[model samples]
Target: MTHASKTTTKLAEEYATPIFDHLTGHDDALYIPLLNHAQSQGDVSPVINLVRNEENFPYAIAHPLTGIICLLAVAESAYWVPIDRIAHSESCSSCAPIWRDLKNRVRTLKPGETFYAAATTHSPMGETRILIDAEDLEN
Candidate 1:
């Protein structure tokens, strides 16, 4: 894992603000059940594997934007998943509707739009940051 670079942090704040606001504004009660469900099923290895192997994940981009979205969502909600767990589990189907919903919303970002994401290790000693521009999606 690596820390968020300056560029990544700036772009992430710019792009993720609206999305995070939208998610947080909703009735949080609706997400409690799903959060609880994900908590109970603690195994997230599969999702981690996919994140590490971007080629295996269809939505791969220059940045781990999806993981960042997942991190933000979990942070704002009652989702018990840790940041590290959620970062890797962005593609985890068993997680909940919120993860998928966030991913879908992120996918809708228009061309030229850009964002940054940082996946930090549990120790907080390191993190990996990615800068995702819409153009990266074209490849």
Candidate 2:
């Protein structure tokens, strides 16, 4: 790989709390810092408020490129919480469309390009967590 490809993104360095054996849909990801690495400066913007706290509903950081969630940013800010501290499973069938769409967009984007991401879950209502969207970065 080229040196640029080997270089990690700033987002992963600042956020991305690595995980071990956390279930995922993609390759053997030590974690989805790949999502952050995939992210570019000023790329992500929250679509909804993912609150992080005991009292609130659960949310996680997901990326279609990795096809898994590695970070949980909720309640206040993005990637503000260390993902390892949260308990989350791999991607579910319900959220497959999100991943599929993200993967499709990957075809067009140059490496190190930007994407938007977010995560929110409400099992009772059947809402799925999502992350990674190069095509929908503006939304």
Candidate 3:
């Protein structure tokens, strides 16, 4: 490979290790489960989720009048399916109540909200996901 191309590849590899990719999942498991995983892993950086709707994670922007502006995106999907096996085997109907709760609670989450845990990964329905037994998590 050319020197420039090699450099670019190396940079990509270096950066890709930290990036987490998630799939179209039911409910906002990204915030609940993923967030919990990152926290357990001692990830100090904001959960950089790279799937559900592209967004910048904890990237700051400078402002002339103000000091600075920081933006964060919660990588949460808006879909929750029933647990009925007749349709989807990966149904989350058992967590229907939680989904309803999140439906209301998530709206109150601001982009600049402070948080302790956040995670992102490319796991399909069959793959294992980090889970926490906490009843509620508030930022």
Per-residue lDDT of candidate 3, residues 78-123 (tens digit): 1111111001112345434433443344355565443222233223
Residues 14-129 of candidate 1 have per-residue lDDT tens digits of 65455444433433321322222223355322222112223432122223433344331222211212232232233323435445544454466565432322334321112333
TM-score, cand. 3 vs. native: 0.21
TM-scores of all models? 0.23, 0.31, 0.21
Q: What order do candidates take by lDDT, descending?
A: 2, 1, 3
- Lowest-sum lDDT 10-residue window in model 3: 79-88
Model 2 pairs in collision: 50-74, 50-75, 51-74, 51-75, 52-74, 52-75, 61-71, 62-131
Misplaced by over 4 Å in model 1 are 1-10, 28-139
How do these models rank on TM-score, best leading?
A: 2, 1, 3
The C-alpha RMSD of each candidate to the native structure, in angstroms, is 14.5, 13.9, 17.9
Q: Which structure is stronger by TM-score: 2 or 3?
A: 2
In the range 1-139, model 2's lDDT, one tens digit per residue, is 2112222333433333333223222332222322443556542322223343476534454343432343444322334223322332135343344345445555657886645455554432255444434332322
Report the error of model 3 at residue 86, Å: 21
